[model samples]
Target: MTARERQRWAVLGVAAITASIVATRSLVVTDRDRVDRFVDAVSGEVTPGRIDAAMRYLDPDRQPVEITAYEATEAYGPGEREALRQRVRERLRAAAGMRFRVLRKSVTMGARSASVSMQLYSSEGAPSAEYVLRKHGDDWLVETARLR
Candidate 1:
């Protein structure tokens, strides 16, 4: 190849490698980002009958094992997914207009699971909660949440 042509190919190769590196970095999902996204979904606005955003972050097979204010301690099984959604809907409706803020947070990551402990501030109250998430395929789903 001519000298100019060889240099052009080398530049193209470097460009390709740079593009791939950028794409790979963009695709890397950090555990902290997952927790942040979960908080965003849970704290998102919910319409009367639509809670799709929050539901997307939750595992359909599991529900909050314990909720202090609700006095619910028993975990809902897979069959109760709909029921859990309904409860969340009701709570979301009741909490309408209340702004939720994450006061502090800590994330612990495992091979296939993660735990997020956070203190939340809302107009109604300040509560501390821990959420357990399990990685499924390329997504992380909230397996259980303990809210106090």
Candidate 2:
């Protein structure tokens, strides 16, 4: 190829590589972002129904992450629902509007599935919990969460 043609090809190759990098990064779900999404759903104004809405962020179909009790929600009594929502809200609120750090994170990825394990702490440095997340249809869902 001529020098001019070689330059053009090099430019196109660089562009393609850049695009591939961006696409790969976008497709890989970060555990920190997963917890952030969960916080977003439960952050503002705790409501009885909000817990159920936040539950949608969880992927309960996978083993080790799925618990039957959480799996069979949707018929919670008013008081029970409110209590759950309040507890979640309080946890986030206590951690300064959910401003926290992922103390540790690990990810295992497949072509269309992934698992994440993470330890989190509040901004003030209190242990929050260690949990698992699973990837589902371009979204990361909480498989399990526990308090420390």
Local error of candidate 2 at residue 18 (angstroms): 6.9
Model 1 C-alpha lDDT per residue in residues 1-148, reported as the tens digit of each score: 9999999999999999999999999999887677678767765344542367667776567433333444566456677777777776776677775666778888888988888888888767887888888787667887777788
RMSD of each: 3.2, 7.5
TM-score of each: 0.74, 0.41
* Predicted candidate 2 versus true structure: per-residue lDDT over 1-148, tens digit per residue: 9999999999999999999999999998765566566655543434545556676664334322432222342322323544544555564444443444566756565554445455555545544443455566556665555554
User: Model 2 segments beyond 4 Å from truth?
Assistant: 1-56, 59-87, 110-113, 121-124
Error of 1 at 50 (Å): 8.7
Q: What is the number of backbone collisions in each predicted candidate, taken in the order shown?
A: 0, 0
What is the lDDT of every predicted structure here?
0.72, 0.54
How well does model 2 score by local distance difference test? 0.54
True lDDT of residue 34, candidate 1: 72
User: What is the Cα-based TM-score of model 1?
Assistant: 0.74
